[model samples]
Target chain A: MSLHAGQHPSTTAAPDATTGTRDWLIASAAAIVALIALYAVFFDNGSLIAATGSYLHEFAHDGRHLFGAPCH
Target chain B: MSIPVLPLLGRGLTAGGAAGLTAGLFSLLLAEPLMDRAIRLEEARSHEHADSGAAAVQHHEELFSRSTQHFGLVVTSLVFGLALGVLFAIGYALVHRRDPEAAPWPRALLFSGAAFLAVSLLPALRYPANPPGVGDGATVAERQGLWLAAVVIGVLGMVLVWQVYVRLAGRSAPVRQLAAAGTAVAVLAVLFALPGNPDEVPVAATLLWDFRVLSIASHALLWAVFGVVFGALGLRALGRTAAPAPSGAVPAG
Candidate 1:
């Protein structure tokens, strides 16, 4: 489908701009979340998930190694 | 065109989740045995030193047993996959926005391939994965910092290449390809310029090589599954959306 197909003619430009901004916002949010998740899975070494008492550390130990995350 | 964000994100999550599960299973079946062997080797080495010295060997108890850790490995893979899926969806949306004329599958695959190269393959070349007992505990933080730097540089390099490719849109195909290749070479130069991993491999050469190879294989499987699955889903979504909507009907919000 064409990007502008369903837009009302009068409001087309406004919606186009709004959609661009919205897409950026969503992408930015997704990026942030992905980074946090990456840290948890790949780099967490009992510092972030200390409340779990290194449980997360041990659990993801193999994954950390498998994924080439810095692990000792 | 102008794909809805939610559906795109949903597909990414699903694809990533599936990819992660497959990778997790792959690692469990193949990599786990190697890891167990490494851990045992590490223990034996430590014991030998202890036997020769006056100091007694202190056993560090595992909080989670091998079985539980195996379970955790799968779960962690799932979570990792889901995270990647979200990122993949974002990438798809951006690509679709810029090049709406391309078929969904090709675009998805291309993006996935680039992602694998930038995120997994390049970084691994610099600081290959080490199995348990291979890396020194003291240098972990520094090693991690360097690895993160490599990932960031790799990603930035990809962005630079994409920008150059996009900007040279009207140029001859060969010229454009050359520019891309040139940019990649430059990126590699920067990557190699970065400091190397501080810790040395303590294990036997064969074991270290096998572990590194398997580590890379698992990542490759993850990306391969993600690309194929996400592309298939993109094709399906496109088919569903290609049908004409009722005249003047507002687009589904």
Candidate 2:
């Protein structure tokens, strides 16, 4: 698949603007989503979703402990 | 020639997934039992506290039986592994972009090790995980904030270190090493200087100690496996494929 770096014919050419932009967009989106999920797991507890009443807390309980997120 | 982006990302993701599965299995086999023990200890302590004429407060209803919880745990680990693998692959692509001539295995190992430190170990040192029944329920928000802050700082500190290393790349090895070490020391100093979040747990000292040790050990194992496995897999991928040549260059054959 020519997946190794410097393996493609374009190596000598400047980085393709389109490809770079697309990759950047994808990476940024994924990071943002991951950060939101992180927030829910580490900080949300029941405060952000008070209607859920500890459901999020309980759902993330083991994970919180596993990832070193402090929860009593 | 530059590598094709998609295939590189795909291989990285595949390798990461495989490593994650192995790490997850290890967690299930080794870490779960220790956690369960801590849970049991807390249960007994709570029962005794309730018996002392205090109002008994059931935290939450168990949604599944013990066996189910165990099964769910394995499933959770697998999903977590998959997600982490994808992230690792993305990171590899970025690093590979920067240093195209670097050998894959060594580069992967370096990247993974850096990630383990920036994302896991450094942050954990500041806000170590506590087993169930540790800490105050009322301060959950504050504790969470401190933990997140540590993670953010660790990541930024690592980025700063990487920048310093890159800037010093042309210098003598000793000079570069000294620079990196100095930057690292400064980062650690700031990280430790931050205010701490000490928790009050009702559990016995031995139980708490055991839980914390197991917690750290499990994560360490996961990261170590991730680095080795990904390094090997990336090396294989690199070996199997040759770089594309510029147009008009005759094929070596």
Top TM-score hit? 1
RMSD of each: 5.1, 5.6
Counting clashing residue pairs in each candidate, in order, gives 0, 5
True contacts kept of 1: 0.66
Could you tell me the C-alpha RMSD of candidate 2 in Å? 5.6
Q: CA lDDT of each candidate? A: 0.79, 0.66
Cα lDDT tens digits, model 2, B1-253, are 2333454455555655665566556656766776677778777777887999886665646755555555544554445555566666666666566444336566666777787898788988887777766767778778777787788788889988888888887899899889999999999888898778767766677776776776667666666777777667656655544433222322111
Clashing pairs in 2: A7-B243, A7-B244, A8-B1, A11-B1, A11-B2
Q: For candidate 2 chain A, which ten residues in a row score worst on lDDT?
A: A5-14
User: What DockQ does each candidate score versus the true complex, computed on alpha carbons?
Assistant: 0.47, 0.32
Q: Which whole-number lDDT from 0 to 100 does residue A64 have in model 2?
A: 61
Error of 1 at A47 (Å): 1.8
